[model samples]
Target: MFALRMSLVILVADVWAKTPFMSEYEFSRRRDELIREEREYAGHLRELTADEKIVDNYLEYLKWQEFIATEDKFLPSVGLEGVLDDIVNSKVFKTLKKFPKGGNMHLHENHILSKKKMLDIVFASEDFEHLHVAVDVPESKKWRLDFFLNPPAGWEKVKGNPKYTKEKLLPHMTMMGSMTEFAKVNPTNSARRWEEMDPMFSRLGSKVIANVNIKFKYLESYLKAALEENVQYLEARSSISSRLYTLDPDPKYNSTGGKRYIDETGGEYELQENIKFIEGFVKKNPEFIGMRKIVNSYRGASVSEMYGDMEKAVRLYHKYPSYIGGFDMVGEEDKGNSLLYFMNDFMKMYDNTTGKSLVPFYLHNGETNWPDDLESSTNKKDPVGTLQNTYEAVLLGAKRVGHGLGFFKHPYLLNKLKEHQTAIEICPASNQLLGYVPDLRNHPANNFIRMGAPVILGADDPATFGYDHFTVDWYEAFMGWGLRLQDLRHLAINSLKYSTMPKEDINAAIKDKWEPAYQRFIADIKKEACAVDFDASTNAPAISRIAPREGPMKRSTKVYVFGRNFEEGICKGVRCKFGNAVVPGSYISGQHVSCNVSGLRRRNRKGAGKSKAVGVAVSVDGGATYISYDGQFTFVRNL
Candidate 1:
C-alpha cells in the first residue's frame, strides 16, 4: 500500500513541477538560472569578438619558443645577467628586428643612443683631448668622463690621465654598468650615494658631447637605428632641464667642477634652436614618418619648481604647436611630487589662460611600487600611492599615462581610459626591471586589452637596459605575455591611433602607410609558413583558412575542418594530423570535423612545433582523408 502511494505522489509532483501548480519560489529560481546562463553566453560572445583576427604566424612563434626555452630565470634585465640582453643577441631578436613597430612614443632623448655608438663618435673625433674624466675608481676600473669642445684652460688634464685607455674609455664615456656587479663590491647603495651617479650619467651626454653640431649627429644616429628596427616613427620625450651645453664655460667658475653650466637665466633660446634643428632632421629623414616632440618638466622639482617647468613647457608647446606633440612630468614618479600636489596650480593656470592649452598633459603618473609600508615614498602621506597617482592623472586630462603601473590597483581606470580613448604608453622592459611589474603574464596590460583600452609598447630608457630600438619591447610583449602577430598588429596600430597627432592625419597614415605595411607583413608570414606561393591573383583553396585561431581553447584545441568538394571514398574513416601528433579521437562530416592534437603546439621536447603542416594528402581507407591546409595554429600557452 505504501509503494502504491509513492507512485501516485510522483505523478502529482511531476505534473505540479511542469505546469500551473509550480511554486513561485521554483519559478523565480528557474528564472535566475536562465539569467546566469544568459550572462555566461554574453561573456563568451564578447571574448569571441575581442580576439583580433589571427593570421597563421609560424615563424614568429618558433622564435618565441627558442627564446623561452633558453632564458635565464635569475637574470635581471637591468644587469649583465638579464635574459633580455641574451634575447637581444639571439636569432629571435634578428626576426623581431623586421617587425614593423609603429613608433617609439616614449623615448628619452638623452638615453636613446647606445653606449657603443657614443664611444665610436667620441673616438673618431679630434676632440678626444677635450674629453675629461671627473671621477675615477681604478680599484674597480670605472670612471666618469666629460668633454669640452673648446678648452677653458686646465682641460688638457682629461686625456693626460693614464687611468683611461682606449679599452677603458668606453665605460667611462657611458653610465652603462652591471648593477649586480656594483652591488657586490659596494655593500648598500643609499639614495644619497646613488644620487652621485645620476649627475654623472646626465653629464655624460650634456658635458662630454658638449657641442651643438655633434648633438645633431647624435639625433641622426638615433634615427638610423629606429629605421633599421622597422620603427617608422618617433615621439622623443625630452626634459626641459637638459638645456644644451653652453659653448662658452663662464670665465669665473672652474671647468671640471661643472659650475660653468649653471646659468641664472634658463636656456629658452637653445631650446628654440634645438626645436628648429629637429624640424630640419624631419626634412632629411623622410623615411621616418615624422618624429614629434613631447616637452617634459623634471620630476625632481619642488611644487614651485614643477610649476615653473610647466610654464616653460606650455610656452614651448604654444611656440611649436606642430612639433610639440604634448607636455609631461618626466622623472621617477615615486620620488617626485605627485601630480595632485600641483592640481591647484594647474587649475589656476588653466583659468588664467585664454583658451585650451595646446600642451595637453601626458603625465608619467603611476609608475610606482605603491608600497604597503607608510614610509614607502619621500612623501609618506602616499598610503595608496598607485591609486592616487592614477586618479590625479585622469583628472589632469593626461593625454596618455606613461608606464601606467598603478592602473592595476584600480581596474575602473581601465574603463575610464577606454571611455576617454586615452592611450597608455606601456614600457615593458623598463617596468620589468623597475620592480613595478616583475612578470608580463600578470601585468596590467592584460586588463587594458580585455577592456579594449588603447596601449602602445615603448622602449623606455632603452640605452639604460641596453636595447637599440622598440623591437626588444615587442619581443617581450610576444614572449612575456603570449601575444600573437594579430595582437602585435593591433598594438602597433594603437600606437598610431592614440598618438597626439590629429585624427585626420593618423587616419591618412593608416590608409597610405600602416595598412600597406600590414599586408606585406601578412604576406611574409604566409610565404615563410607554407612552401606554396601565395598568389594575389589566384583564389587559394578555402581549406587553407581556419577560424577561432587562438584561445584558452587554442592549446590542445579542436580544429573544426572546412573545405570544398567531397568524395565518399576519401572521406571514409578520415584521419588528420597536426604536426607529428595524430588526432586521437575525431568526428568527421562532409565539411566539418574535430581533432584532438590541440591544433596547436609551439614546441615538442625536441624543440619543433607540433602544429607545423605542409600541403595536400588523401586516403580512401579508414586511416585516411583528402586534406590540405597552410600554416600551423602556433599554440599560445598560459595566456
Candidate 2:
C-alpha cells in the first residue's frame, strides 16, 4: 500500500509538470498581445487626431467602458487565472509596483485576511472534532467545547430547554451534505457552508476573536502579505475593545443580555499592546517605514458613545504623537449618525481640553447616493445632502476626504477643495463593487480631475474585494480616468507627499529617497523612447514632391477700378477703369475716367476734375432717377 501511494504521488507530479497550470507561458503570451494592442491603439489615436471630432467621440464612447474587466465575460479567452498573471507580469504593473506608495489611508483592520489563513483557522479549530465543519454557528449545530462540556452552569434555564442530542447536532456540525442541500442554507448565516460564499471567502479567512494574540497574529500575517506586494506603509482603522475575552457568558465580563463590558484599562491596554506590536515589527522590518492609527466607531453606537470613542482616539494621538495619526468616523456612513450632528460637541472638546486639534481628520464623506429619506432616518443624508457636512468639515480643517462622490453637485464646495488643496482618496473599484457606482467609468473623480482637483487612488479593503492593489484599484484608475502616464506618476508622488509622516522625515525621504528613484524611472522611459521610433511612417519622403531650383522669380503688379453705382464688380489685369453709362468718347485723364467727355479730346478745365460727373444712377425705386456718389450724379433717360 505504501509503495502504491508513492507511485501515485510521482505520477501526479509528472502530470502537473506537463500541464499549463505549472507554467506562465500562456500568461506571457496574453501580456504580449495586450501590449501589441495598446501600441496599435496609440497609433490609431495619432491618426485620429487629424480629425478632432472623431477623437472626441471615441473618448466619449470609452467613458462607459467598465474598469478592471475581471468578470469572465470581459476576460480574454485565456480566462481570469491567466489575466491576473498577465497583469502581474506586465511592464506597467512592474513599474507601478516599484513606486514608493507612502501609506494605505483606508484599510479596515478587521477585514485584513487571506484565503489560506482563513481556511487554516476554520480547519484547525478543535471544536469540530468528528465533524467536517469549519466554523461554529447556530445553524451549523456544531456545539463548541464551552457549549457541550462546560455549558455555563445555568445555560439550561437561560438558553430555554436545551434539546441536546448527538444525532440532532451531528448533521448540523458536518458539511458532508450534498451540494443541493448546502445551497438551501445562507452561507452568511451558516458557518458550516462558508466555502460557498463568494466575495467573503475570496478576501478573508474565518472570523477570529478580537484578542491580543489573535490581533497580533493577524497583523504579522497581514504585514507579511503587504510586504510581498511591495506596500511600504499602512494607516489601518480599528476599534478598541475586549470583546473576545467577554464573549464567554461568564458573570465577570457579561451581563444579563450577553453584552460584553470593557473597562477603561482594558481598552487602553489592548491599544498599547497593538502599538507595541507595530513598533516591534517596524524595528524588525525597516521597509515597513510608516504606521498610523484611525479610531473607528460602530454604526449602531449612540452619539455619546461615539463622542467618547473619538475622545479616546484623540487622547491616544496626544499620548503617542508619532503613531496615532488621525481620527475617523467609520462604519456604515449611510446608516450611522451624521458627523455634523456631533460636530459642535467635538469642536468644544478639541478647544476645551485636547488643545492639539485632537487629530487630523480624514472622513468617509459619501459612500452612497441614496435619497435622504431612503437612508436610515438617524443618518438622514445621502451623498448630495452630505455635501454641506463635508464642506463644514473642510472649513473645520479636514486634512483629506475619503470617497467624496457627491462633491460634483456643489461646485462651490469643489472650488473650496481645490483652493484648500485637499486630496480625495478614491476607491473606484470598491465603489463599483458596493453598487455606489455601477461602473468605474461613471465615477465622479473624472470631473474632479478635469476641474483641477487633487485626487489619489486607494484600495479600500482590497482583501475583501477579491483583488490585489495592482489588479484592482490602480487598474481602475488607469482605465476609468484614462489617465496618462504622467498623471499616474503625479498621483504616486502625491500619495507619499500627503501621507501622515512627520514633516521633517517626509521632506528628507522625498529629497533623498523618492527623487532619485523617480529620476531613474524617467531615465529608463527616455531610453525606451529613443530606441523606439514613434514616427516611423512619417520618416519617408512623399513621392509627389517638387524639387527646388536656384533662381530668382519675376514679380508683377496690376491696378483696377470699378463703377460707383455697381454694388458688385470684378476687375482683372493692369490699369482698368469703369464708369456709369453715357454717350461719350474715351478721354485722356491720366489713369482716371470721368463719367462723360463730349469729344475724343478735350482740354482740361479748372475744377472740372472735381465737378460732379454725369452718369446713370442705379436705384431700386422702380428704376426711378436717383443721385449716386453723395448726390453728385443723376441717371439719364434710356430711349
Which candidate has the highest lDDT of all? 1
Model 2 regions lying over 4 Å from their true place:
1-95, 118-209, 242-264, 352-356, 371-388, 468-471, 516-639
Off by over 4 Å in 1: 1-55, 71-81, 136-142, 149-162, 171-176, 181-200, 241-281, 351-358, 371-375, 379-387, 531-639
TM, every model:
0.69, 0.56
lDDT of 1 at 284: 75
Model 1: number of backbone collisions: 3
Candidate 1 C-alpha error for residue 575, in Å: 10
> What would you estimate as the lDDT of candidate 1?
0.59
Q: What TM-score quantifies how close candidate 1 is to the native fold?
A: 0.69
* Candidate with maximal TM-score: 1
Q: Report the lDDT tens digits of candidate 2 across residue range 1-639.
A: 999999999999986775563223234334546666765532312222212222222222222223223434432222122244555654555545654454555676755554345334433444222112223344322232221223333323112223533333322222221123433332122222223223242112222334322446667877766666556567667676544322335565334233243435746666676678878987887666656767666644666787787777778778877767777777556556666666654675556554546667777775656533344334443222433556555766667778888677667877788788777888765565444554456678877765667776666665544444533456556655666544555566666666767788777656665566555545554444334332231222111110110101111111111222111100100111113323221111112222221221123223334332332232211222332332222111110
lDDT by residue (302-395, candidate 1, tens digit) is 7787777777778877776666777787766656666666776677556345645546877776776554232234665433443477887777
Clashes per model (N, Cα, C within 3 A): 3, 1
Model 1 alpha-carbon miss at residue 355, Å: 8.5
